[model samples]
Target: MTRTLYLFGSAAPPVFDVARVIEDAQSGGWDVCLGLTPTAADWLGEGLDGLAALTGHPVRSSYKRPGDPDVWPAADAVLVAPATFNTINAWALGLTDRFIVGVVAEGIGKGIPLAVMPCVNAAYVQHRAFERSVRELREMGVTVLYGEGGFVPNLPGQGRKEAYPWDLALTAMDDLVPKREA
Candidate 1:
């Protein structure tokens, strides 16, 4: 079976540059599954449809459809980029109200590799709860990229001055791609 990577995050940057990331994964012979938070879908506008088309798979946002065969993919790794404070806290606490968090919780529990890229203000990042959560996730073996050491809104053409590592988001996927079975 093809290794699957679950993409989770909020839609902040208008040009989040996800197409190339998806294409790269496909080229690596891995299946891509996308899960968008409600706020993310709103910010993405029509970009969500474009992502679905690119991956040839429907993007999931909620956990209401548990019986759907396609609700969750057999992901080999889960990458939560542009991960909002709310999403991070929710996932850390094991609240699976949304599809993305649900799948992440499931994946982690099942021993699948997981990576998180938190995208929130530095103040929020320093919160004790957030710190504890990050530590807990690490203890659970999840790779938390922890944004680029500060808080910055995701905007295109802003250079690499922001705290978030947009480029590393894709690079993390490269790290997660499974080796072909001999």
Candidate 2:
């Protein structure tokens, strides 16, 4: 069975990088579901159509569609790359404002492993609430992949001294999938 991976996050520089990661995962034969934050959708452009083409699955951004009876597939794992500080806090507090949060909450309830790659400003990253939320997520058994540095826009030499490798992210997602018994 192909493992379902739910990708969620905010609009940051690493979002482009995250797209590459998703492409790699698709090439590796994983079924991918993308849920973008409003801000993320804006930055990503093309309204997930490109992502849908890449993954061959419908990319969901909202939960307000009427008569959309297709049940979201149970995810084998959840990856929140380029996770904004706002998203981190919302997830930590169980806020279900959007499709991404709803799916993540559902996955957590089902005990699915969740991997979060946080990319935000240094000030926000050091905020007490953000720090506390990170601790809480860790306690909840979510694997937090810490990205180095903030995603500053239009600033030369100011973001991610070493960006998280796409392959490493894919490997982490693969690790969450259970090996089938032969």
Global lDDT scores for all candidate models: 0.72, 0.72
Instruction: Compose the digit string of candidate 1's lDDT tens values, residues 1-118.
Output: 5777887767555226566667876777668877788877776668788899888787777775456565546777888877777877888899987878887888887988888877
lDDT of 2 by residue, 1-182 (tens): 57778887677667766557777777766778787888887777774787877767677667857876765576778888777788889889989987787777677768999988777666676579988888888888888766443223223346662554445566777777754443
Task: Give the worst 10-residue stretch by lDDT in candidate 1.
Answer: 154-163
Candidate 1 lDDT score at position 176:
68
For each candidate in turn, the TM-score is 0.80, 0.83
Q: What value of lDDT does candidate 2 attain over all alpha carbons?
A: 0.72
lDDT of 1 at 39: 78
Query: Residue 169 in model 1: shift from native, Å?
Result: 3.4
Q: In terms of TM-score, how similar is model 2 to the real structure?
A: 0.83
For candidate 1, the TM-score is 0.80
Ten residues in a row with the worst lDDT in model 2?
148-157
Q: Which parts of model 1 are misplaced by more than 4 Å?
A: 147-163
